[model samples]
Target: MAKQKKGEKAAAGGLREQLRVPAGPVDLTTYDTRATPGFDGSKDDGKVALEGLGAEVSDWQERLFAEGRKGGERSVLLVLQGMDTSGKGGVIRHGAGLMDPQGLKITSFKAPTPAEKRRGFLWRIKQALPDEGMIGIFDRSHYEDVLIARVRNLVTPNVWNRRYDQINDFETELAAHGTTILKCYLHISPEEQRTRLEARLDDPTKYWKYNPGDVDERQLWPDYMDAYHAAIERCNTPEAPWYVIPSDRKWYRNWAVTTLLLETLRELNPEWPVPDFDVEKEKKRLAAT
Candidate 1:
C-alpha cells in the first residue's frame, strides 16, 4: 500500500497506479472499455470477488466511521462520472452496498436549480462532503460544470474555462483539509452504452431508468469527449487523481471499483479510536450494579 513514486511502476498491478490517467493528453480511445485490468478472472469470478470484499470493506468502513465519530479529521470522497448507462448506480449498489450505509454519504446530482446556479456549482457539493472518518460518494459531481456545462453551453466559454482553476483550487483545499479524493471516470464505449440503453427499454422493470434525452446526448458523444479530455487534462493533479474504469463488463466494473475502494481503505488504515475512560473502572462499576 505504499505510495508509488511518480515514475515507478506500481507494485502488484496496483489498480490505482495501473488505471491512473497519465500525464499529458488523454485519448479515451486508447483505453479499452472491456478490459479488466489487474484481474485475471471471468465474470462469475469477478462477482464472487466483489462479494468476498463485502465483509472486509465493511469492517474497514466501520473503523473509518468510528474514527470520524471520535473527532478524526480524515475523510474520503469518491467521485464517479461517465456517459449514460455507465453504471454509476451499479457501482454503488454492488460496491458500496458492501459497506454500512451509516459510513457513506452518497449524492446523485441533478441539473442545477436557478437558486443553485446563483450560489455556484460547487456550493451544494461542499455541503454534501462526508464528515471526518466517513466515505463520501458522488454519483456525478462538480466536474459536471466542466463536462455537461461545457458540452451544452450552459455557460460562456470564458466562464467554464476559468472554472477549471476554481475546481482545482477547491480540490486542493479539500485535500489540504484531509479529504482523500478519488475521481473515477467510468469509461464506456458508445456501442456498449447503446446496448445498455436498449436493454433498459426492453425490460419493463428498467423502463423508469430510461430517458429519451440520453439519446439526444449520445449524438454529441464526440463533443462530450473533448470536454472530458480538457477537464481531465486540466484538473487532474496529485491531490485528486483520475482513474479510468473500463466499464463495458458490468461485473468487472463493479469488482474493480470495489477493489479500488478496498485498496484505498487499506492505504488509509483508519484505526478504531481507543476509549478515553478507565475500562477496568467502568467494568467494575457495571459488575457491582
Candidate 2:
C-alpha cells in the first residue's frame, strides 16, 4: 500500500491498508486516536481533499443505483460504530451527503423498542437494508447489540457473548448475496469527546443535539472500550473488515471514511445499464411520431 501524500489520493489500497485492523487479539489502547495515517496534510488540505471527492463519489453512486434498478443484486452497507461525540453523524453529513439522496438509504438505529427486543437484535437491521443497487449507511448498527448490550448489561452475558458468532455468520450471508460490508470504528480519545461535549454545551443552538445521558455514558468509558475490542476482534472478517478511523480530528475522520467508501464503490465498478430496445429504431419511431 502506498502512502497518501498531501493533497493527493492514496496509492491504490493505501488508506484502506493503513487503517484496516488485522484479525487477531485487538487492543484499543495501542491505537492512536489523534494520528492521521495515510493522509499527510494540514487541516485545510484535508478539507479540500474531502471536497474533491464529491463529484466522483456521486457519479459512482448513481451508476450503482442504476445497476440495482436494472436487476443488479450488488449493494454496499457501511456500518459506523463509535463512542459519544466520535463523529458518526458528522461523517454521514459530510461524507454520504455527497451522494444523491435517491441512491442512499441512511438508517440511524436508536435503542430498540420492546417489540424490537422481542424480535431479536438483527430483525430491525434487516428491515433497514438497502434494496438492490443502493448504498446503505448505518449510523449505529447491529454491532451495538454487542457493544452497548455488553457494557450496559442490557442483555445477559451469554446472549451478547453468543452474538459475536451470529454477527459474523450474518455478514457472511450478506457477502454471499452481493452486499459489500464496510464497518468503521471511529476511534476518538476521551479528552476529545469531553471537548466536543463541552463545545455543544457552550453553544445554545447545539443544545438540541446535546444529551444529558451522554454524560452518564461517559463514566463507563473503560467498559465500552473493552466491549469494542471484543466486538471488533470477534466480528472482523474478510467479508466485513473493520477499519479503526482515528477520529480526534473531525476533518480527517470524515475524509478517511469517504475515501474508503469511494474505494469500495470503485471496486464494485457498476456501470450504466444497456438499453434493451434498439436505440436507432426508437429514435426513428420517435422522429416519425
Candidate 3:
C-alpha cells in the first residue's frame, strides 16, 4: 500500500488503517458513525473475531508481562476518549477482559479532586501510566483537559490552547521511553448518543450507568464536536497516532478497537525475555529433587 500524505484521510483498506486519523485538520462529519468501512464480515463474524482476538491478546500480554518481569523495557498504553454511552467500558469488558488482570492496568479518570487540581492536570495522569510490560487503558484520559476543559470553560483559552503542545510533548516523551501509545476517539452521532441515553432510563439494570449530567453535556454537542476536532488535529502525531472508531454499532466498535490493539502489539513484537539462568542446570536440579 502507498503511504498516505500528511492530513490525508485514511483510504479503504484494513480496519486499523482505515480508522486512523490523518494528520491535519479533522472534520468529524466526514466519518460515518454507523458504517463498518473495512469490515466485510457479518455481525457474527465480528463477534467471533473479537473472541479470537481475546486469546491472541492474552498470549501477547503474558509475553509482555514476562518480558517486563525479566527486565524488558516495553509497555502499551491505550487511551480511550468518547462521549457518554460510547462504549469505553464495553471495550474494556469485551476486549481487555481476556488479558490477565495482573498484566492490565485500567484507570477511569473522573473529575479532578481538590488535591489533584492543586498539583496540575497531568500529575495524576502521570501516576496512572502503565509500568513496563503491561497494557494500560485510560477510560477517559488527559485529553479531557482539552475536550471538557475547553467546552466547559474550565480553563482560560491561553491554558487550554497551550495544552495541545504540552500533550504532544508529553506523548512524544512517552514514545521515546518505550511506551507504545494508541489513542482512540470513539465517534458516535448525537442521535445515537440520545438513543443510548434513553435506553438507560428504560432499563433498570443500566440506570446505574446513567448520569444526569450527560444529558446536560449533550446540549453542548456542537461545542464538544469542535473540541474533539481540534484535539485530534492538533495532537495527532507520528509517535502516538489517533484512531477514530465508528461507534454507533457496538460490535464493530469493539471489533475495530481489538483489531487495532492486536495490530499494534503485533508491530511491537514484544518477545519473552531471555532467561538469565541456565535452563539445563535448573532442569537437572528439579529432576534430582
RMSD (Å) per prediction: 3.9, 2.0, 4.7
2 or 3, greater by lDDT: 2
User: On lDDT, who's better, 1 or 2?
Assistant: 2
Writing each residue's lDDT as its tens digit, candidate 2 over 189-249 gives: 9999999999999999999989999998999999999999999999999999999999999
| lDDT minimum window of 10 residues, candidate 2 | 1-10
Top-scoring candidate (TM-score): 2
TM-score for each of the candidates: 0.95, 0.97, 0.94
Ranking by TM-score: 2, 1, 3
Where is model 1 more than 4 Å wrong at Cα? 1-13
> Model 2: clashing residue pairs?
none
TM-score of decoy 3: 0.94
Q: After superposition, how far is residue 132 of candidate 2 from its true place, in Å?
A: 0.9
lDDT for each of the candidates? 0.90, 0.92, 0.88
Using TM-score as the measure, name the better of candidate 1 and candidate 3.
Answer: 1
CA shift of 85, model 2, Å: 0.5
